[model samples]
Target: MCGIVGAVAQRNIVSILVEGLRRLEYRGYDSCGVAVLADGMPKRARSVARVADLDAQVHETKLDGATGIAHTRWATHGAPVTDNAHPIFSRDTVALVHNGIIENYESLREMLRGKGYEFVSQTDTEVVTHLIHSLYAGDLFAAVREAVKQLHGAFAIAVLHKDQPHTVVGARQGSPLVVGLGDGENFLASDALALAGSTERFIFLEEGDVCELSLDGVKITGRDGQAAEREVRNVVAYGGAVELGPYRHFMQKEIFEQPRAISDTIPATEAFDPSIFGEGAGAVFGEIDSLLILACGTSYYSGLTAKYWLESIAKIPTQVEIASEYRYRDSVPNPKSLVVVISQSGETADTLAALKHAQDLGHRHTLSVCNVGTSAMVRLTGLSFLTRAGREIGVASTKAFTTQLVALFVLAATLGKQRGHLDAAQEANYIKQLRHLPAALNSVLALEPQIIAWSEEFSRKENALFLGRGMHYPIALEGALKLKEISYIHAEAYPAGELKHGPLALVTEAMPVVTVAPNDALLEKLKSNIQEVRARGGELYVFADADTKIVNDEGLHVIRMPEHYGLLSPILHVVPLQLLAYHTACARGTDVDKPRNLAKSVTVE
Candidate 1:
């Protein structure tokens, strides 16, 4: 995934474009580039560094224009280099910025080369500029439509032509592209955050939709050249919502926001109304004999947590599959199987593909648990549950993962009740506990200062180990992922009970061992695991509940969490680990929001 931003008829728009790029940088930031139409030609500046470097160069050179397109690349077809950055130009006429992969770029490149078009950068995006220049007939929109027709695979493209300085044309298929409406100017960005300061009114382009933008307005059309009407949506602005809000990094803020996110995710009583599930979900769930959970990354871990919940609470045999690997496997799902897909973006490529594959295999009872309402996964699935985590900008997921877990837990409980596996008292208890999660999360949020202090020790640590038991094991894996993603720390997660089997030998004083030891059935075993590490001279950091009876003596650093969370301990236990990763990244002086070589969405397989 890469970030694309375009503005038409905007004066001194370089700064605005750069700001938009900064906001969208979470999408991709391997390199940055901007193209401005000046003096009847496209003036392009690009660098293989952070956006700030390119912004400085543009300011120092006084690159000025009204209409422009900028991109922060996450290399796909080529390595990160100045020449490989976007907005790729063609003979001073057209400039293009692309966000998705072009599977048939080699064939297209060969055809273009046969037409005497010489390429500069080894990027599939560069092919678009050349193709547009070759087919230019004074109609930029028509040329874009023609160029897109020749391409294959997922892409969200923004094109700017020197001849049509006041116009910017874009097309989307299998990638996110939003149109932001403004006065005397309009915006095109991969996400709404890019245009947050400029406009709140947006139009989320559907697949196969094409649009042309100018200072006046946006014109919509379809791939078949037919006029298309788009729905204008009023996006609720979460102004400064990305800010830490008294926390450290957005990760830490998001970690603490999980409790509220879970509370928000609890299905309304109206959802239990017979009219909502239609003739009751009993008939639909009754026919299901098995369950499949498909997801990727941290969402995959949430699915794993859900598998345990559904198997234990609902008595439904469940399987958790990583979406990328799921689709390529020969596994077969029966007609009585209920396929559940989990995704934060809901646009995650592999997860969406897995959903499609399951649907193709004739499983119509597919359900999607997603954060975004209009996501591709939502559109494709027959049934859906929405998690209201708002917007997650940090590349490493925090609120989204916890919200997904909450949604899945609710689903599992609902299924248990419908299947006669859970009694009224059990369901009521779960709902009551769910209601108190937000407040319990607030208690965990209070641990931020202590976690930040712990980060100082991590700064000197070259490697770290995360240990947990039962449901907390997945959380431990997630914590390790966060540390490695943002802080570049070599961290690994191991089941506390399995440490003695192999990983215990790797423990040393130089390595910090973070343990998730809530008051669960496995607490005693986890305590012994902690002692095993401490005896090996390894530094110990424990995130335990208040009544867990864990001692804080001798190389043991304990951050007491709220006591007696029961099954909801996973939701609370992840907070300190999230803060640890966030503060550690900050201590390491890493880009806390936009991690290196990572994109917000994996739109490509």
Candidate 2:
């Protein structure tokens, strides 16, 4: 995924374009660039640095215009360098920025090259710019529409022209695009966050919609080439949601926000309501004989953890599948199955496709645990639990992962009660645990100093191994994912019992073995597994609960959590791993929030 922002306003929009790019930096930040129609011609500046660097370059070049477009490229086509940056120009007439992949760019580029249109960059977007410029007959919007008609694959593009000084055009086929309404000004971006300061009212463009923006007004065209019905709605963003007031990175701030996020996602459990999933959750649970969880990335690990809860607590046969593979594979779908999809953004492409796949296979009941209530997943699913982890800006998820786990646990408890596995007293006890979760999370956060000390040593290691059992095994997977994703380290997680099979051969004095040691039934077996690591001269980092006997010793490090609730320990154990990853990436001088070649949302397949 990449971010694109365009503005056609009365005053100079250089500052607005820069600010919009900054807000959308979460989508993509490998490289950034801006193009504006200055005086009578389009002026462009691009860099492989952060948005701040691009803003400085624009000021240095004195690039200003009433109509402008900006982009942050995630670089799927070429290297993340200035040459591969967006806002690529076609002659002196057209400038363009794009957000999605063009599957047929090679043929388009060859066709344009034969037409004598010189190419400057190795990007699919450059192909679009050249194609649109080749078709230009004095009308920018019409040229863009004509060019898009010959394209294949998903894209959301914003175009600015030197000739059309007061106009900006945007078209979307698959990726997200929205138009912001202002007084005598109009804005467009791939996300609503980019328009936070400009307008409260927005038009969320439908699939295959194109819009022409100018200071006068906006004209939207549907895929059928007819005037489209536009509905404007006021979106309420959380107060101070995107600010990083006192944190080192957005990832660090989100790690600390877990306490509030977990509390808000589950709320007070005194009432012990089954409507936690939705108003119709009880009926859905009553009819389903099995559960299938479809998710991707960190959300997939949450689904993996939920498999243990659903089987042990609810006593239901459960299966977890990666959404992308599930969509392509021919899997037998049970008619009485409740298919659950988990995503933080609620716009994950593969997960949405998998949900449709299950629906098409005659599985009628669908549910989603999502953060954004306005997301397509929530709209398509029959039931949803909206996690209140507002505006997760970090690409490697922190609060959203834990919040999904919280919501899933609630769903598990509701299912258990529905199936006569949990009595009223047992459900109330679980509710009590849920109510006390926030304070427990606060206590667990106090272990950050100890985790930081571990991270100092962890930064020196090139490789790490995480081990756990049962539900905590998925937490181990998420832990290793967070470390390798942002820290640029090679890490892997395995089931503790599987250590003797193959992974033990790779352990050495240079390797640090991280273990998630919750005091569950497998603690003794996991202790034996830890001894196997220490016996091989591998340093150990153990995250254990308060009641466990794990103590710090030579080659063994233990950080005790406040208290552990059975079936809920995975949520607490994951917090320290997130902090460890964030601090280790910081110590190693790596980009913690925008890691190389990674974007926040995967809105494309």
Candidate 2 lDDT, 426-459, residue by residue in tens: 8888888887787888888898898999899999
Q: In terms of TM-score, which candidate is strongest?
A: 2
Cα lDDT computed for each candidate against the true fold: 0.84, 0.88
- Per-prediction tally of clashes: 0, 0
What does the lDDT come to for candidate 1? 0.84
**Which residue ranges in model 1 land beyond 4 Å of their true spot?**
9-19, 47-66, 137-139, 180-187, 196-202, 213-234, 237-247, 268-287, 527-539, 553-558
Best by lDDT: 2
Q: Which residue pairs come into collision in candidate 1?
A: none
Model 2 error, position 8 (Å): 2.0
Q: TM-scores, in order shown? A: 0.88, 0.94
